[model samples]
Target: MTYSLLNLAFLVPAAVLALVATLRVPHRRRFLRGLGLTLLVVLVLTAIFDNVMIGIGLVAYEREHLSGVFIGIAPIEDFSYAVFAAVVLPSLWSLLRPSRRRPRAHA
Candidate 1:
């Protein structure tokens, strides 16, 4: 399969995990805010590093698998990995966190 198809296969599961995590976890607003911030940081870092790697011939993508889009030398499709990490990691963390219990009041 082409790289683009492989990316799509992974992305669909990552998106679903993020959605289920947001719905099931507590503090939805905070989780969303954190996710947004994470996405922004990941996007910036991926753009810088991926472009630099491609520029120096340390990395490359097969043109046939790409959608003919570019952000500098990095293929636009490359950003999907960073985005998947940002969403999936935090969602998994939230899902796996230990639950907190409230103290009982004395009568």
Candidate 2:
């Protein structure tokens, strides 16, 4: 499969997990704001580092696998991994965290 298709294969599930976590987790507003900020930071860093790596020939992507969209020399597909990480890591963390509740008082 093409790179974009492969990226979507992982990204779709990660996005779904993130959405479910956003709905089920407490403090929806806070989680969303944090997710947004995390995405922004990751995207920016990925773009800068990816472009530098590509320019230096340390990183290379097959042109046929790319969508022809780019931010600098990095294919847009390159950013999806960061996006997936930003969404999936927090979702998995929230999902796996132990619930906190006090035991009921004895009669």
Q: Give me the displacement of residue 88 in model 1, in angstroms.
A: 0.6
lDDT of 2 by residue, 19-89 (tens): 89999888999999999999999999999999999999998988988899999999999999999999999
Model 1 agreement with the true structure over 34-98: per-residue lDDT tens digits? 99999999999999999999999998878888888888889888999999999999999999988
Off by over 4 Å in 2: none
TM-score of candidate 2 against the unseen true structure? 0.95
How far in Å is the alpha carbon of 85 misplaced in model 2? Answer: 0.5
For model 1, give the 10-residue run with minimal summed lDDT. 1-10
Question: Runs in model 1 with CA error above 4 Å?
Answer: 103-107
TM-score of each: 0.91, 0.95
Winner by TM-score? 2
Superposed on all Cα atoms, the candidates' RMSDs to the truth, in angstroms, are: 1.7, 0.9
Worst 10 residues of 2 by lDDT: 94-103
